[model samples]
Target: MAMRRFGVAIVLSVILMAAFAAGLSAAKRGISVGEWLSVPFSDASFAKRWGYGETNGARNVISADRAQQRNGKPTLRLDTNSGFDCWVYFPNTKDWDIDLSKAKVMRGYLRSENKNGWGGDPWIIFVDMAGRKARFDGLKQRLYDAINDWTEIVVPVGADLDAKCAEYGWKAQISPGFDWKHISCVQIHQDTDGSGYTMWYSGFEFIDYAGRTIKWWLSSINKPDLSVTYAEQVPQYKRYIASEPDPNYNIPELVGSAATEKHWPNEGEQIKYLVHIKNAGFARSKPTDFVCMIDGKVVKKASLPALAPHQVTTIVVNWKWKQGPYQFAASVDTKNKLDEITKKNNTLRFKTDAYVLVAVCEKSIVAPIEQVNNWYGSFCFEDWMRGATIDQLNSLFKRCKYDFAPNGAEVSVRLGKIFLVDELPDDGAKIGEIDKGLGLYIFDGVWHYPLRAIHEWCDLANDFDWALNHELSHQLGIIDDYQYDMGPDSNLVNHKAYDRGPGGIMGGGQVGDNVYPAYADVDIAGFNLTKGHRRGFFGEYLYCIPYKNTLVLSIDGRPLADKDIEIYQKSMYTGKIEAPPVFTGKTDAEGRFPLANRPVPKDFTTATGCTLHANPWGYPDVVGRNGLFLIRTQVDGKWYYGFIDIGRFVCEYARGHKDNAVYSVKLMPE
Candidate 1:
């Protein structure tokens, strides 16, 4: 019903183990001082201990179907339409007394079914000697602003009761000199007067004052995100059924599993929005105010009338913001304006873009458009679009779907038309309308955009498509996976935490080779799909080449020039080598080679081992005893062929996939 479902096994097992270790006194884990009674409303034996009946005693429950459940488990359900029903534990009979002196707070899980019943005044009254009652009225406002979601109730009793609550013990309506000791009964009453509502419940117990607080020591995995799998939630599923003991719970229940739809907007264009806010609780929502925020700023505010349980309503908000991706959030009463339970699930988030198409006709690529077409599969369109004609982009974009890479970012950009000089565009004003100028007007390198990519000489740079999508990715909010100079631990793109190596389009060298998006990227795009983690070595290196990190070379102090970086495998003992460059690529800016996992090794291994999944390739971090080396410069260029543990290098430099790390290497000049 909230952010994440817990691993029932871990929680249940831990409790069960603790109970066993504590030498549970044959009382179902009930401890001394206070007991967390498992009064399952469905368990006839337990219900008999604390009898259930209506206020009139004659009102008989027609059927058990009225009993509600969450995620399909039996829960406490009160249908106010039947009449004002009050149930008490250890009633006025005084046969069983609960000592509130030490066993302090009374807690229970509460939620309403009929949202319209929100205004219902629910109370927890503690009855002691002289038939005097001390009502825990502190929950009055909370019940009034209730939603149809489960929330834990912690009301003080006995010494834990504050001065104001103790004063209620001396009121006229209640007998004076109310005593906490020999407390006869505790009653849960809701008077909706036939306004008909429902509140599902679970785990009602009385424990020491120390247990009054609700502690949430949870992991991010328990919080469930786009990357979480159903298999990981098996323990939670099993635990629900065991605790709730509902046959229906045998089938899995889903919550907040809906994917978001992209809302494409235009730059500086005002638009009306109909945002929906849902009440996931049973009692009627006390008068509510809905607030909508965009990019952290409150863009719209509106008041909502009382809403029924599980009801939803839409509010209109006007927005006219600048281009790029936008993060939209709608919160139900962020302020403490309503008396409600938990504020956990009151807010929802969405992602969208405001796109524009523009052209840079400074100098068209000499090669055919086919080369650029291949980049689309590799996802370099954002980096290879520089100096392209508007017509060429039109053809390519027509086949493309709207997507953002580097996975998570809040920005959007539209491809606007770039006008040709004299014809309709220039640095100056023109008759035609151009919303914004794509200032990619200057570049000196020769680009043909052809399949047979050319090299300046013997050194070939992996500069293909870098100027286009690569440059634009920055504007779109995705950072380079390669950090210029950060340490391995601080590498944002490929850190130890990153298990999805060589699988995302956001990565540098390696990403360039594969030109792909990791599963996280797909999720960020709101696509319910997984391509599985792409696994393979760049050659015999046992992993994707130097892709996640950038290597800048300096020969005897200056940027090394006219040298190519070659990687190959060598024997640890014999120093024997495999001929041919496992990978061959030159550098840019004299000696900087930004790599990508490219030429996508033709012979991808089918033997499985690397990850939790049966991946065909070994783990990126495990490169075995076989030594792997990198040649700083080749062919009489002065640098000698040396073996460097590429795996250890990856462990060090290829850390984060969110930022670039430039590792500078100093070599002797030829």
Candidate 2:
């Protein structure tokens, strides 16, 4: 009998091992087999001792002594009946302990003499770790229907449809997430099977990436362990295959956020805060709570609406605390209610310098200056901040992890008030016909702006709100982008790239509904002439703002002291020359005055009637809006005017005036 068995083993090995080399070639590419497949089950006493000898009929009886071996090698074999059911469990379930945390798939092989009843029920591989347990199921119905003699089986972790198990079977529901670490127990079992069959299963193991090795003992030889390769190419798994999907669709993440300015000089200044919220998910995120804490104390809270997949929203908050070092921490969905991929990123802690904001609202021109400062607008200041509503101007300083505009520089300004006055704060009184155009001035560290004058420029404002942003940029040390000939010898021109890419605030005096400096290729369009992007340069001087030019005054070769002087815009839309003072000042004891808002956008009277020009010409030699300008002032207790050419004087100033004597002008009798 032993001689005949050996001869039969040699013959069967040739037939069974025909495809062994093919499987080995695939194994070389990265594949593995389960160690349980090779573990001996050939001990006759072992199979009978374990109840494998049970039988209902001649053909449906278990292998009593050991079936024919292929090449004298042993394997687990079963001669099952049409209604057979059994399982081989380890010393309790812990004997199946193995770390599969990094594994990508669980694979094995199944072959049967009678394919009809072999896989009626799925071959279940149940795993458990710690107290958590989950089953890798679902393909039993599919496996029962498989026709091939050598069937490759694969069960991907985390991503597979769960089948409705029986009373003691696993519930059909989504697995929270795979606990691949410390897999303490596993069961290789079959339930409710059928029909006379002889089956064999061998070389199974958990595998990670493609090109991994199977720790199965038989891998020492060239025998192919094709479980991993077969798992991928098998058509039955095609529909169930996925890129390991997480049951939790999204993770509401709160990246770290901080104040636009980390340090400030004063204590009674508002500290800006930005809380970044993003949806790290494949689907839209539900409404979540955003919380702010200062030194472990809840300072602010806001409800963030649903965010699209990968969408981001920045919550701007302005809080005031005693000037000192305060740890600022913000978190999203702190209640731990949402099922996220990870909870680590739900909170972000930032150390910042917390201070209070000392801001006041002063309005004029019968305009509610309080409303302008308190009421919120679009962009940064959209609503009340912190415990109480703060100044609208104060909200612009909040910085977020993301820059709304790619090129928009993060400019952090000093904590200050948003002064709202009707007429440039103490303009004394409105003189003659006032033009709509307005200018911003800095005096004694206070920003002074005209109130009622904003209505006049309602027609000239490139954007209704762009003026504020443009001026704020200036205060942050940004230069004007307009191309202007400072003089005949010096024509200042800036980068053309920034000049056109994105329409920006500093680019032009444009005002009204507009976006930030997000450049795109398009023609400037506007409902009103001043509504769209203005053609101007960008970043001419990043850290430097247009400085106020100085004018030295003299009358008939003598110093003109305490003389009332104002810069006017004589260029009108009618292409005609007209005189209208836009800025006012007084000559100091040294007969000098600081001038700003030069070449103002004013209407002028030309031969073609009244054509509005962007800047004041004031001279025929410069071909500007006005033929000449009058520097009206009181000289020797009499009204005397200095006829000036705007462009010519600017050119002269650039070419000749390099010292404190910026523009030496002799007031002549007009």
lDDT of the candidates, in the order given: 0.37, 0.36
The regions of model 1 sitting more than 4 angstroms off are 1-264, 295-298, 324-329, 334-341, 349-566, 569-579, 582-670
TM-score of 2: 0.22
Lowest summed lDDT across 10 adjacent residues in model 2 is found at 225-234
**Model 2 misses residue 525 by how many Å?**
78
The C-alpha stretches of model 2 lying farther than 4 A from their native spots are 1-73, 81-85, 89-93, 114-121, 140-148, 158-178, 191-196, 214-670
Top lDDT hit: 1
lDDT of 2 by residue, 256-325 (tens): 2311212233455565555555554334456778777877788888887777644567776566644444
Candidate 2, 370: how far from true, in Å?
88
lDDT of 2: 0.36
